[model samples]
Target: MDINLEMINLIKGEFDIHVLIELPQTMLHANIFDLNANLNEYDSLTSFWPVAGKWQLEYLEEYFSGCESVHFVIYKPGSKLDLIKTTYKVLKFINKHKFDYLQFDDFSARQAFLLPFLKLNKRLILSIHDPIPHGGEFEWKRSVIKKMFYGKAKAFITYSSFSKDLLRKTLGLDKQVVNLNLLPYTVFRKFLTHHTVEQERGYISFVGRLSQYKGIDLFIEALPTILKEFPDQKFMIAGRPAFGYAVDSSKLANMASSVSVMERHLSNQEIVDVISKSKLIVCPYLEATQSGVVMTAYALGCPVLVTNTGGLAESVLDNYTGMVAKAISSDAIAAKILDFLKLNLYQDMHAHITGDQLVSKLSSSNLETLSQIYI
Candidate 1:
């Protein structure tokens, strides 16, 4: 680890402000990235971001105008020795000045181990994105870590009412829980296209990190039926696979002319090109708790269809910004996709979702409204 004693002294002087520590490579990073983009100056908030987000944050940092940040280097989760070493290094680094509060943008095992050593009077706040583990996550371990954080946190934030309700009703949360909508990932705006809804040229697409919980199989199951009805329609699957996929691509193997599959992760420009020009994107998740992908599609003025699971439907207004499938089954997904096409709803959503109108309604943080809570 490189130590910059002079840099530490400078940032240390800037402490005693609210510090939002965000986990890397997750929606939490995207959330802070979006909020930071809208900030006019370095006010009460000082944040810690991972080096992984440097690709986008570096571009934003120029106008960020000394809104101070500590970009910590982190090892990908799964190493206990590294977590222990990193925790101690962090303890020695910033334990000198007590902060106004530490808003944990997300929780992690490393934080669980470090919490007891912090004898400071700083208030602790946590944001809960998913109440439970997804398909292949280590439920026992993550649940233990979350339980520890839940007990220590003074307040909690949830991106959707559904998640808040679950924490209160299911987990029996005794802490004050505030619900807030996650801001759109404005970091992607740098690559946004000028494609209008009427001028869109991309085909039906699925864009996200693929996993079993995402239910990509359900959509693929319904595709043949869809292809039969509209053989000329092209479909693109653009995401890298993770945690073992539930679907078999062989079913779509013969439909090369109609379907295009890219089983790797997409770069920012690639994401923009695919989503900005898309006719509509479908999210066939078996379960979900809000979605950055839904918000990203809206940011790009693309229509979306989501299954009625968790907080996914909360991301869009049914039939207005986007539509929702009646059920999680293939038949339901196919029927809704058919409805969207036959009614021409896909071509009608741009005016409702583009520009500041949609951003103000959906993405605005209402800093004033939130000021009372953060403090």
Candidate 2:
């Protein structure tokens, strides 16, 4: 919500800031990607490029209430033909507007291909959320692919210092890098502040898109052991599965009655409600860059249990803001959960996570740093 705060501070009138979205309409509708499935609503500061249809355009117009400009450029999926279509549209827009700088939050192969063809008088900045993609890959191939996309940019932006170090090491770059600790999903603050689920403090919830790497199956495998001791403790799994992954109902069938699963897209409000009601949020990812889920949990004044992988553990302060699993193993994850629940670390974690000092640093100073980087 950097742009929103910028507007609130009367900074938008000082500099021309525009939002461009090269939306893959086909995939957006098909829900092929992790984040695209829930695009029915826009929660960010910048307005959406309504490439889907006029109705979406209208919705975005209303959604981006304080922003002035909202433009749309549509293309097919991420095939070769789709690249050509998207490049053509992007080129036309760049030529017409003639912006001084173009910043891309997506440093994918598709964007890398389209970068060379963008005939514009603009300095390109590649905002690398995950400097190195999560999971192990051949070092040479990883380096090659990263340099292919990132090498084309004039500068780079990383959301966390951990990502910046990883990017520098991966790309072997000496270029200018801007780092911000956490990116707040501040729009939820308004709604989340007004409403809380008022749930009874018992269920341990795992929320977010389900996938193999996300460790939902690991969570499940750990369930039997957890239920052995705290049989009354409920485990709730919320949110839709990752694009093509299946929810093996068989896994849940023979489990204790304390397990509850809701396998569908949850609305923004629904997510806030679930998190608000949760006694603890579990993110047992095998790998990750940064977690918006952890930030959300903090915003809702709920503690988290995250595996010590990538930037996931960086988002948490271990025994303070939340507990971290020592390893990705199910045994490790189960043990950590039991420790948090049984040891009664919630009050301290809640205090630390929702404290005024940390909250201001994450939301105010962190966001201001981001806005300054754009200029």
**What's the lDDT for residue 32 in model 2?**
15
lDDT for each residue of candidate 2 in 1-375, tens digit (9 for 90 to 100): 222332223434444666655455444432211234333233222235443343333323333444446554444443566456566766766677877777776554555666667753337777777665444333565466667666666677776667877877756455667776663444455456444745555678999887666878888888888888888888889987764665677877878498888888876667777887788999999888778788777767889999887778887888998888888988998999889878988888888877778756655555566565566
lDDT by residue for model 1 over 1-375, one digit each (tens)?
001121122234443332334333233233223322322222222244433254345544332334454534343345567556667766655565455666676777657777888763537777678877777755677778887887777777777777878878654545677777655565566665565324555588899888988988888888888878877878888887877663476788888788888887676667777887688889999988888888778767788989999888887888888889999999998898888777877657866776566556542353333455656
Candidate 1 ranges with C-alpha deviation above 4 Å: 1-57, 62-66, 73-86, 92-94, 120-122, 170-173, 193-200, 362-369
Identify the runs in model 2 with alpha carbons over 4 angstroms from their true place: 1-15, 27-68, 76-89, 108-114, 119-122, 135-148, 189-196, 243-254, 363-375
Provide the global lDDT of candidate 2 against the true structure.
0.67
Candidate 1, after superposition: displacement of residue 216 in Å?
1.1
| lDDT values, one for every candidate | 0.67, 0.67
lDDT accuracy of residue 230 in candidate 1: 79
Q: Tell how far residue 244 is off in model 2, in angstroms.
A: 5.5
